[model samples]
Target: MRALVTGANGLLGSNLVRELITRGHEARAMVRRTSNVEGLAGLDTSMVYGDVRNIDELTRAAEGCDVIFHTAAVFSYWGYTREVMMETAKGGVTNALDAAKAAGSKRVVLTSSTAVFGGSDGPKVLDEHAALVEVGVPDYFASKAIQERVALEHAAKVGVELVVANPSLFVGSYDYRPSASLATITGYLGDPLKITYPGGVNIIHAGDVAIGHILLAERGEPNEHYVIAAENVTWREVHDTISELCGVPKPRIKVTRTPALAAASLMELAAKITRKAPLATRALAEQTGRYFWYSNAKIARLGFLPRSMRQTLTQTIAWLLVSPHLTNKQRAKLRPHDDVLQAMRQAQVAQRLKSVRIQDLS
Candidate 1:
């Protein structure tokens, strides 16, 4: 199959492109002029330049592609105005569908976040059936909800098949932006003392998410939403895993919800004063102690398979070792953990070999 992937330089998009090529499919990677394509290095895919907001440009880029994967968005908690973020979200969908129709693409697979499933303070599992709550969700999430709605409506109106893949927090390679989760890990690496909070979230490898997107295109029902996730882990568990992987001390301080929110607010205030992005954001803090757990059974019906959290984190850390997003100070801090990182990489290789042997035996 030939496909066009927007935001092709991003974490999910880059991995999706790699997965497409690995599966012997052709991919046209549509990225902006200024996008960093380091993650796409050595990938055997055609590169096209276009913005998702421009229908004419996107149409030209989508030509000859059987499937159009819309994965472009302003993925940040700060540094973007609400208007720009919302426009990129909702407008991107409208343009992508239009472009799909204009280019005669068969289907458009949109990448939405699991944040659309309003999180709970407790461990309430969410699925695609959950309703999106707009009362107090972050702008990023609200925008995604709007994007999903627009895609569903527009696809039906324009006569284009649409499938949505809502993935949980990603933890795999090709993450050039490094994602917010990876940024947090980098912060922990920079500081010896790790701090934890009472929050939980679903984590999935970006590679598995890429597979989910492809499955959605191939076997997913039209207008269906699929949750692609691997593990639901608490913040403490997340930090502990990283600590073990890096051979560093585990989180020693557990900040409760209220104080954590306060800290996030202060950090945001300081960021504004310093004209920089904060490590933590109030939007994330507002979901403190909430369990963003999800069930991927819907996608499983389509033969979707996701890696374990350990496997995801292992690959992520291995990538982080060479990621250019890391600061010099952060790299220096991580240098001492080189032995631990190498050991983890070797163990991952052995585990994969064992899994392959088991599969062959079966």
Candidate 2:
């Protein structure tokens, strides 16, 4: 099969490209002229330069392909206007589908996100049937919801074959540019400071996510969505794991939602002023302020099993240790100072426990 993979330079895209090549399929990678090609090095595939939002460019790139994997998107919670985010996501998906139909592609796999489920409370495990509540969700999540709707609606109208894979936080080796998951982990590594949050996240390995895309293209039902996730863990557990991997002390600070929200808002303001990406944004804080767990039962039923979080983290950390872009000093600087604060908080709690014991004896 001749396959066209959009965003072939990204984390999941690179992995998917490699998988397709290994499986003896003809893979044509669609990348922007300015995209990082370091990930594509040594991979056997043809390349086409174009942006997904450009319909003419995409149509040209889609020529003669049997399948299309639409994996490109602007993934961020801050630093973009709602118009830019939504239009790009929805436009990209629409263009890809149109191009696929014109090129006589058999299937077009759209890479969506588990964020479509939005923020939730408690330990609820969301499946594909979970409805979206757009009231206070982040722009990125909202954009993905729109993207999925557009893809499915277009597929129905055009009689095009389409499938959507909604993956959670992706982690694993070959995270060359570091995703949001890696950024959060690296931040904690720099400070060893305990950061407190109210929510949890389900994580999947990027390689597994790439494989899920293949499976969906081969066997998924048209217009259906599948979640690709492995484990649901809290912020505390996530931070502690990074600290352990980096040999840093864990954070003792247990910050609540109020302070975190305030910090994120202030950061967003500063980012706007500096014309730089915010360390955290109001949208991200709102997301972190609630539990965002999901279940991959649908995909698992299709023989998609992901590696354990321990396995994923271990390999990811090992790769980071030797990464040319991050020197030892540079890596040390990435740890969050919050770890020491968390430790201090733990000490205070221990002291209070001792005091209570003495008072009871009196």
Candidate 3:
């Protein structure tokens, strides 16, 4: 199949492009001219420049593609106004569908986030049927919900095939922009004493999420939504895994919900006054102790197989250690001793052996 992936340089998009090539499909990567292409360095795929907001550019880039994977949007929570976020999310999808129709693309795999399923205060497991949590959702997540709604409605009106892939927090290598999940992981890795939040989230490998995207395109039912997720883990568990992998002491400081929200509100106010991004926002603070868990059985039925969280983090750290995207300070903070490196190597080997054994048994 011939495919066009918007935001091709992003964490998920880059991985999706690689997956397409691995499956012997043609991939036309559509990225902004200003986007850093370091992660896509060695891939053999056609490259085109375009913005999802501009219909003409999208139409031109999408020409002759069989499917269009719309994954372009600002993923950051701070530093962007609500108007900008909504427009990019909603308008971007509108333009992508228009372009896809113009380019004769038969299907469009819209990359939406599981944030649209809304967050849970306890250990509730959400599925594709879950409603959007309307109260106090951050603009970033709200925009994603809006983006999916608009894409589905608009696609129906335009007579285009649309399948929504709602992915949870994904971690893996080739994160050139170093997505929000990666940023959070690096922050924990950068400081052993950093405070931990109370909330939990579903985590998956970005590569696995990429494969899910392809499967959605090829086999997913039109107008249906699939939550592609793996393990559901708490923030403390996430921190503990990283600490073990990096040989750092687990964080002793735990920030409860009330204080976290207070700090986030103050940061939001300061960011508005200073026109700078805040370290925490009230939206994130609101989700402090909540659990964002989802069932991936829908996608799993289509043969979606994700690695364990430990294996994902182990590979992530191994890549981050030598990634060109890291600055000098980040490099220094993430640098592990010989013992930690050996531990990671041992873990990788053990995981490989276990996978082989499982396969042999099956």
- Report the number of the highest-lDDT candidate: 3
Clashes of 3: 0
Query: lDDT tens digits, residues 1-362, model 1?
Result: 99999998898998899899899998888888888776777666678877888888899998899999999998888889889988899899999999999989999999998988888878889999999765597888888888898889999999999999999988677677667767767777665558877868888888899999999989989998999998888878888888887767889988777887898899999998999888878887777788899999999988988988777777778767665666676665543356447744763453343111001100
Evaluated at residue 207, the lDDT of candidate 3 is 90
Models, CA RMSD each? 6.5, 13.5, 7.1
Per residue, candidate 2 scores C-alpha lDDT tens digits across 108-196 of 99999998887577877888998855557788888898888888998888778999999998865455655566776666655445565
Ranking by lDDT: 3, 1, 2
Which regions of candidate 1 are displaced past 4 Å? 327-362
- Number of the top-ranking candidate, with TM-score as the measure: 1
For model 3 the local lDDT of residue 32 reads: 77
Q: For model 3, which pairs clash?
A: none
Question: TM-score, each model?
Answer: 0.91, 0.88, 0.89
How many angstroms is residue 224 displaced in model 1 relative to the true structure, after the best TM-score fit?
0.5
TM-score, candidate 3, is 0.89
